[model samples]
Target: MSSSVPHAKPGGRAAAGAARAASPSIIVIGVGMKMRGDGGFGAAVIEALRAYPAVVDRVRLAACDGEPARMIDLWQGYRCALVLDAVRGGSERHGFVYRRELDPEVGDFGAQPGGTSHAVGLGAAARLAHVMDRLPGRLILYAVHGRDFRLGAPLSGPVAQAVPELAARIGREVLGALAAAAAGAGKPAKGG
Candidate 1:
């Protein structure tokens, strides 16, 4: 259950060099099933990101089955991580994108049970990981509203359109984080 996601080169060889220069990495976990309609949003995002190797390398990528226990194994050791998935049952309209920054101190993730397929939601797993000291220091969840969960159905049109845009946004965030980390590392120690 070690991370098999390689250090991807977003822009190619030149980008790989840049990635090597920058530090502090981010992990992106996509949770869903490819066979299920829009429920497969997470895998879609991961697929879109695969086009950018540099981005893929900078960020650890995981396509999960919405199983909380298995997900913990993929994210261990990372300080910051982002999770992408499909969700239902919120005030948000279908195709709506939502972002939630998790607070490790919060025991209850407050995630509505049916939003995702797992018996224990991503939030509860996160809380459990927190208790076990396995949770990342900073974690963000980005959920895309799903319109269908039918087995073997293709992703709905609207959700399909959002995948590339979401991937690009995540790419920018990854680069920004790396840049910030590099800048911070270059700074002299406060006490020195």
Candidate 2:
């Protein structure tokens, strides 16, 4: 789990079918800086996800460029929100992926403001949303640890290799969430 991608299942077809089977109510928010080396993890995930046309059609995907305000608006009225971002200086090594829930009760999964300079707005915006009572019911963050954040840089080798697997994980999680929601509402899960 530390060295390789977890949940190594192919999600392209399943995700596409799931998207086509129901209304799109899940939002995946990808936030990153495009030119800042591995800091562009969110954008990479979004780019990778775009390959599934059906999923793209049914799910709301936003490459927020680290703007938490935009993320707030993009996820409004959505059933679930999945956020991706890059962070540095964490216990996780470069290219490490961290997935955690942001329940309304627990606040922010122990995430502090300014975890990464680029992610400052994200933490703050989450607090603002809490204050304004605008948070989605289900919020999760899939954050990747970044090595280089210099301008005009590309993702390092490890980070680049991890993007596809991470994207697949995002798809699976989104589909699962949609399925659970459908089940809770007494409807069959789409594409299950």
Candidate 3:
């Protein structure tokens, strides 16, 4: 699933159609340091998602260079927040993933703050959100195992492969969240 380029660019028309009105209810954020090898996984996955406009136009998308304050602000008022980043030092091998929900309900946010490759990563942002009472209704993190953070190096093989998979999964997440919200509001989901 991993590669530098998006799987396809044929969705240009669909992507263009995403210019419809209405703010998105969910925000998908990719947090990473683009200059560092696998450390840029978050940003890479975000680029891959450009292939899916149905998902793109339905949600707010952002790429953060691992700034805690900015990250917190991006998800401030959204109903749901999804974070994509790379991590290290887990019992699992390279490319292993950790998915957690940390919000009104804890969904096993068990990974240590130190595991992240970011300098002042989501852990600090989560802490800030906790203190400020600014967490979204739903907050999820998809952290993929990685290494080779050497500057100017491209993504590690494993991390690159995970990009497409994460991109597609995140697309599903955006759409599904919209569907759920529509059902809750008793209306058809926009652009579904």
Candidate 4:
């Protein structure tokens, strides 16, 4: 991951507060690289989400380059952030969705010499955000097991086929989070 942090104005606090007041609950940052096969999953999910009218007003969609610092910059103003990425976790055959709550204490995943090419890795960005006290209390990572990361125009078979399902799952998760937040706010919850 690159260490170049995208510089945002110091006014992120006010923007965050205003976003919170105007939205249903949280923000979603879809991190992906279109040139890298399955790595484009995040972008695909966002496209799917855009077709859903129910969520258009409640969520903010951002397409990231998978650079850790850039990712952090994108997430700076949300109450909760859900990061979607493609991972070669060796569990693709099991057809499972990999989800993890990233601990801000763990620095960037790409910090290691041979780690992913993502600049500054997601873990590192999360840690930096935490240290800066700018991290959302609830941050979730959804990693879809990927079969290929090769430079290509399309996703590998397994990952490509998983797109619709992944999109639906993300949609459900977002709805659930929103409903829960609403309930906590003493408002009638609408969706599951």
**CA lDDT for candidate 2:** 0.73
The C-alpha lDDT values of all candidates are: 0.77, 0.73, 0.77, 0.67
lDDT, candidate 1, at 63: 78
How would you encode candidate 2's per-residue C-alpha lDDT over 110-155 as one tens digit per residue? 7532275474556666777777787888788888888888999999
Tens-digit lDDT string for candidate 1 (1-192): 223544555688677546434634577888888788988898899889889887866777777786777777666667788898888767777777777888778744455423874456688778778888888778888888887889999999888988998999989888888888989999999999
Worst 10 residues of 3 by lDDT: 1-10
Cα-based lDDT at residue 108, candidate 2? 65
lDDT of 3: 0.77
C-alpha positional error of residue 18 in candidate 2 after TM-score superposition, expressed in Å: 23
User: Estimated TM-score per prediction?
Assistant: 0.83, 0.78, 0.81, 0.76
Residue-level lDDT of model 3, residues 1-192, one tens digit each, is: 122112335567465335322457688888887788988998888888888989877777778877888887777777788999888777777877668887454433655533888777787788778778888778889988887888999998988888998898888878887887778898667898
| Candidate 3: regions farther than 4 A off | 1-22, 103-108, 112-114, 187-192
Q: Write model 4 residue lDDT over 71-185, tens digit each, in one string.
A: 7666666677888777655624623456778565653332221223355556777777877787766788776766567787677777777778877887888888888877789
What is the overall TM-score of model 4 with all chains considered together?
0.76
Off by over 4 Å in 4: 1-24, 89-96, 104-117, 187-192
Pairs that collide in candidate 2 are none
Worst 10 residues of 2 by lDDT: 1-10
Best by TM-score: 1
